[model samples]
Every structure is written in structure tokens, then in C-alpha cells.
Target: MSEPLSVSERDGHCSLVLTRPARGNSLSADLVEAMHEALDSAERSGVRLLSIEGDGRNFCTGFDLAGLEATADGELLARFVRIEELLARIWAAPFTTLAVAQGRTFGAGADLFAACSVRLALPDASFSFPGAAFGLVLGTRRLARRIGEDAALSVVTSGAVIDAERAARLGLATGIVQPDELDAVKQRARRDALRLDTHTIAALRQAAGDNPIELDRDLAALVRSAARPGLVQRIIAYRAKAQDKNRTDRAAAPSTFQEGAVR
Candidate 1:
């Protein structure tokens, strides 16, 4: 059975919610493909604004490391490129893109939020990137541009949970809203976009051009470098350890775990 992504609309805003609640809204190939399809429908529906959020405890925990354990070498390399390609679409979408993040948003999930023009977050939401632990290279160029190279390295190196306030201070989030006010916040996001002159928005989007493509190229190269035969075994081992750690952490105490499976 296919996992359902909840779709809702209010005040010119169309929201796409990741429905997998048991696995922390982790990304799998299926979820990635579903996200693309959702964006396609959003484009067709003339949604003035589009927002993506998680249905459970995490906005996204990261890629499914368990799934990646058996992923083919060819596909491992392809994943980074594909993720970046989708991000480009988000960056280039005609309407305003917003990411209303809750819980932890890591790896591709972090990049997913980065792809959005504006990100609103709850005080409890945290952000991190642990992909390096798995040799999963991220779009570092964008990361550096967003938060400066030195800070970006600190983020990747620390891989610690940074709360929403820090994320907002670092440019990763445009606003920090109370968890209870999410609906109102999302509506306000759309209204802000709606108030903007269309020509200005179009001009800015055009000015941005294909800048993300360069980052995609950079990300692809990083993936290709990491996916070379000799490197993967260590990465796989690291992920194994990390997966165990994630399980341990989650099991030790209840920490807003959600998304058993996307499908």
C-alpha cells in the first residue's frame, strides 16, 4: 500500500504533510518520489503558496539509513544528484515555497527546508546534518552560502541538535512561531507572499536563475568522491553504528518519534 501524504488547503496556501509517523518521517526513495508528485499537483492547482511539513515528530530525520544499507552503489551516487535536482525545482517554483518545520530536520531534510524560500519553525524544532557519517554528501555550497563556510563546517562536524532560535539567527529559518499557532503562521506566510508584487517576485526568482544547478554539480561531485569503492564500507559501518545509536536514543526515552513507514 502507498503511504498517504496529507494534503490540506486554507487561505491560498496548500500544505503537503509527510504522513509517515513511525520512522520520524525519514526519507526513502518512495517519499522523495511522492514529494515530487505533490509539487507537481501544487503547481497545477495554482496554489499561491506551498508549504511542506511533517505529520509526526520530525520534519525529517534524514535519509533512511536502514534502506541505504542495501542500496546499490550506482543508486547511492545518484541519490545526492536527485535530491539536489528536486531542491532546484523547489527553489525555482513559481509560487512562494515555505517549510514549516517541527522536530528534527536533518540531512536531506535540512536541505529540503533550505530549498524553501522561507522556513518557519517551532521553538522545540531542532536542525542538524549527520550525512557525513554515512558518506552522504550534502549540497555544501548552498549550506556555506546560507550560513558561511566556517559555520557550515561546525554544523556538519557538530551534528548537534540546534534549536529553532539558533536556526533563525543563522538564516536557516525566517520565522519562529509557537507550535499552537502553526496554522495561523502558515496563513500569514501566504498573505505575506500574496501582498508582494508579482513582478518583483518573478524578477527575483529569475535573478536567482540556475544558481542551484552549480550547487547540484558540486554535490554530485562530492557524492561521486564518497561513493568510490574503497570509501563505502567505512561509511556503511558508520551508518550501522549510527542506526543503532538512533534506535537506542529513541528507545531510551520517548522523543516525538513518528512515521513507522512512509508506505
Candidate 2:
């Protein structure tokens, strides 16, 4: 099998691409670890900008559903914690981070996109977070920081797909452009990112504020929720609901990817 993720750097810009297109670029443990390594390498290399995108139809459909189903409760909670760590790392990265979202960006995928300093999406791109359905609070603080508490609450609780325009309007996306304009947007981002020295960028981000307390609070809430009795049953029910929605959607029109919760 091919690698689930790939990283390449040029002209002080690093690109991290998700490679599991056939699986809707669903994130696996190995894939997440690859991403962490890529971030480490980019930082070590003094990359001025980091760009994330997926290889094919969907940016990412979220965490691997099969992995979720097979993992024991203890292991699953650890996985969720790891995901939160990854998102936090991305959110706190010193230099500029850009996410090029396209197709179905859902759950933790949306969390990752929201974590980026700059997020661009294709006209057809759509984002949703299904974690609320399972009572997961992993990215609540970071997401609210991006789009405000009201919008964040609405999106997460409703599990409604926010299309490109709505995403930009809500500040979930910096901008939306056509597929043909993607390279130009990336170039602009790289140029602007490179114009600032690393120290200055770090200082600016520091001034923007750090939410360690909020993050800790949200994480504690997640642990509490996951530790509750019948938590596993709740996840099962959430997945069933998503599967039912997927079936209905597919009946109306063909879907290129499988649908499920993040777990």
C-alpha cells in the first residue's frame, strides 16, 4: 500500500498532502503520526509556510471509522486525545499554516482546517463536525476561537455541512476560490508568509492570545464525557445515525466517500 501521507518542501514552503484518496483520506493513527513528523521536520527546516491538502476527491472524511469500531475504549480515548494534541500543535505552530480544503472535510478534518492560520477552500468544498453527536469535545475551544462561540456551537451541534461561501462568512475559511486558482492562492500565501521574519510571526501569534486554560477545560470535558457509563453505546448510536444519513444522501445522489463519525 502507498504511504497515507506525504510531505515536500520547496522555496521555504512545505506542503503536507493526505494520500488515502480511495478511503476519503480518512485519518489513521499512522497517518496522524506521519503528519506530526512532517510538522517536526518543517519546523526544523525553518519552513516559512506550511500548506496542507489532500490528494484526491475529499480533503479528509475524518478519523478512520473501521479503526474506531475495532479499538477498545481505553485505546479509543487515547486516540482522541492524540488527535487533540495534533490539532493543538497545528494551532500553535510558529510560522503560518495554510489548509487547502476541498470536497468533504468533516469532523477532525474540519478541526484541522480550523486550526490553520490561513484556510482556503475550493468553491465546492464543504465542512462539518460530527463529534458533537458523539459528545466529543476535542476541538471545541479552538473552533470557537476561529468562528465565535455561537457559530461554532451551531455547526457542531447541527452537523450541518457548511459550504465554501458559508465557511468564509463564518471565518472557518479565509477565502474560497475555484480549483484553477488554488496554485495562485498558495503562491500568495507563501509570499506573504515569507515576508515576515519567524520571530515577528511568533510574536504576533503570541499577542493574538493563547488559550491553554480553555483547551484544558475542553479536554477535561471530553475525558469526562468519554468516561461516562454507556459512552461506547453513545458512539455506536452516533455512527448508526451517520450511516443512516449517508444512505439517504446516497439514495438522492451518488457519494464518492463513506460517511461516519470521528469516534
Candidate 3:
């Protein structure tokens, strides 16, 4: 059976799992729609705690770069805006949102975790926010909340992998556990989370209301900035850099040419 985003529930806990393992659970258009729909249903269903995870070893590898290329740039930009909307919806969600991250989490994937109330990382998992690579501007408030301003800027700009221990220490991840023990840790968290009343959950989130909105504005602005000619050129430059990673010899290809890999 084709795996749509998977959802399951028990007690007051509701869980969402990104499925498309063949593509490393990447957030494609379909997955994005599924996420929005899932949020809608979860809210209507009286879920007290919402848990998000990925089906494969990785939490999420990031946007479906291959899919991103096939679609129009305008459409991609619209989706980035929609993500801002989603972040707001997530913050407004009645339930306490929990991100259960394992393996790779980058770009959009990292943003998803940052949107959550609790971020649980597998000890082997890692994250990155390489806006420099794509000429896209990923903001840092979500990241800055976890790490400081300088480290947040460095990681997002440098596009380097931040490992689990460091992520936890930086506050990017609220808790870190060995991969094998992650399921157990998640279970305890979920169980305790379910006991919390909806009012309590709402109150805790209400106290942080402006935080998500500020981050959303920053993310949305960064995305629009990429639409500018200069940033778009940088985006194109990054594409070549990406291609260089795959090539062996120094013989260069056309900078403007699209590769066998479209995304």
C-alpha cells in the first residue's frame, strides 16, 4: 500500500509519522498537504498531545529537492509561505506538540522540529539548516532559542551537521537518547503528556504566543528574499556547488545547465 502520512492515537495522545521512506521521508507537496490535513483532524479529535515522527531511520531529510525542481519556483515560494501558516497553526494547536527526531533533520525538517514544544533526538541523529547552499533564508529564532545567536547563524549559514549531543546541549533537542531507547523515552513522554489537561497545554503555549509568529515572519521574509535576482543567482551558484559534489574530475560543466539531478 502507498504510505500516506501515517496517524495513530491512544488515550489523549495523537501521533503523526512522515512515511515516504523511499525518499527519506522528505517533505514533498503531497506530504505538506498531508501535514495540514493531519493538523486539522487532530484538532477536531481532541488530542491533548500531538507527537510527530518519521517512519524510516531518519526524522526527515528535508524538502524533496527532486520534486522542488519539477515544480515552479513560484509554487515553491508559496509553499514556504504556507509553512509559515503551518507553523502558526502548529503553535495554536491545542495539544502539546512533540518532535521525535532520529537520523538526519535538515532545512524544512529541522523547522518542523523547531515548531514543536518538545524535541526528542536520537543520539545518532543530526541536523543542518544550509540556507547558504540554496540561497534560501532560514531564520534563526527557533534555532536561536535552542542555540545562541552566533551558533545559530553559523550553523544555518555554514550548513554543517550539528550532532545530537551538541544539539541537546544547545537546547535544540530537549532530550537525547540512544536510538534503541528512543521508543521507550518517547513512550514515557507521551504517557505523561497525555495526563496534562488541554487547558494546561494551552496555557503553556499561550505564554509563548509571539515566539512562533516572529519566527514565521522571519522565515517568510527569508524565503521572499531568495526570490530577488541576486539571491536567485546565489541559489543557482549553490546548485553548481551541489553538482560539483557528485563529479570526480575537475573538468567543469556549464554553470547554468541543469544536471541529471533536477532538484
TM-score winner: 2
After superposition, the stretches of candidate 2 with alpha carbons farther than 4 Å from their true spots are: 211-215, 252-263
In the range 1-263, model 1's lDDT, one tens digit per residue, is 65747777766677888887677787767787878887788777767788888987778876665565566777766765666667777877778989988887877788888778888888878888776665556766667767889988888777766889999998888889987888787777788878765456657877865355675576666767666774446557766676677677678776675323211
TM-score against native, each model: 0.83, 0.91, 0.83
State the lDDT of candidate 3 residue by residue for 1-263, as single tens digits. 68559988887788899997777787777788888988888888888788889887778877676643355667667766666567667756777889988877877788788878789988768887866566676546666766778888888778887899988888888988777887787778777777877777777766865455675577667676656655434545666776676473224555643223312
User: Which residue pairs of candidate 3 clash?
Assistant: none
Rate residue 143 of model 2 by lDDT. Answer: 86
Residue-wise lDDT of candidate 2 within 145-173, one digit each (tens)? Answer: 99999988889888898999999999999
lDDT of 1 at 229: 72
Ranking by TM-score: 2, 3, 1
Q: In model 3, which runs have C-alpha deviations exceeding 4 angstroms?
A: 209-216, 229-236, 246-263
